[model samples]
Target: MLFLKSNKKEKHFFKKNSMSKKSYEEQAEVLSRAIDIAVEAFKKFRPKDFTDVHLAHFVSVYEGYKNDILNPNYKFRTLSALADAKNDILIYFQEGSGPDVNFFWKRIAEEKIGYQRVNKMAKILKRKRIANRMEMDFVTDCLVAYRQEGLISDEESIMLDKMIFDFQKKGK
Candidate 1:
């Protein structure tokens, strides 16, 4: 029991000590330096021969990064931070010699035909005003993803969300 208590105390001490109390400026400088190093390394050593599978994987990971950075609970949630993140993501897409961002989207679309079909079904249900609760939930999820991706305007997302909320609230 004494050994376990000591071990727990040691773990707590390490965990508490590991957290940095750096000012935002200091943190930003560290992040900027890390980004510069990564960019330089990528430029120096990018693979010359990647396959479609690699491209697909890259795009998938890129989308995940985009989603994460745009999430409401993201660490840097300021408007300026979001604008900078958007610019940084755009730079990554535009600077790479690997593949055009549109090509990635086209390939993704080709790969996600089922997603397309579901989206179409949602649209049809929305038009017909007959979407069930489960369908509305799916539409809400899509709206959240679309809003994060900037595929839809904030106002449009809000309007759709309101409509879905109203529909769900009606218990139809």
Candidate 2:
């Protein structure tokens, strides 16, 4: 009697949890279609002043998912991650935006061209022994522009310029 009861419970568990490969593939197809619909709607209905940063990030995530969805050895985690990304994107699109754009969306060009990002790139180039004079010159120009715009401190600008100058002194 106990054996029969356990067998019945096992069958029920399997029935509830079992999903075939075809089922998962079909679900992936549905997710891709949904992403397409959301992309179109977002492009059509978003405000004119709203920049494409969020849209670009969302689309890039989708493109990565799409490219990997058809692999014969694909794992379930990829599908799960895509679904989570989709949910977060939909939440971003749907909530609180009926009133006004967020402060993040109002950021100027100087803010977007972040000081740390440029500094990090320059440091990486120098550390990797790939810091060409032209690239360092470009970095120096960007730092100067950033200083003029108040995006970076004068001291910070001087320090970065000094770093680039030192790198350039070695050779071209």
Clashes per candidate, residues 3 or more apart or on different chains: 0, 0
What is the per-residue lDDT of model 2 for residues 73-165, given as tens digits with 9 covering 90 to 100?
Answer: 445535565556545444433222322223222322223422111244345444643367655645654665456667566666666667666
The residue pairs that clash in candidate 1, if any, are none
In model 2, residue pairs whose N, Cα or C atoms come closer than 3 Å (at least 3 residues apart or on different chains), thus clashing, are none
- What's the C-alpha lDDT at position 67 in model 1? 51
What TM-score fits each model? 0.30, 0.35
- Cα lDDT of model 1 by residue, 7-105, tens digit: 777988767545432333343443343333333334444445646576556555545545544343645644457546544544443333243433433
Q: Could you tell me which 10 consecutive residues in candidate 1 have the lowest summed lDDT?
A: 113-122
Q: What is the lDDT of residue 119 in candidate 1?
A: 44
Number of the top-ranking candidate, with lDDT as the measure: 2
lDDT of 2: 0.52
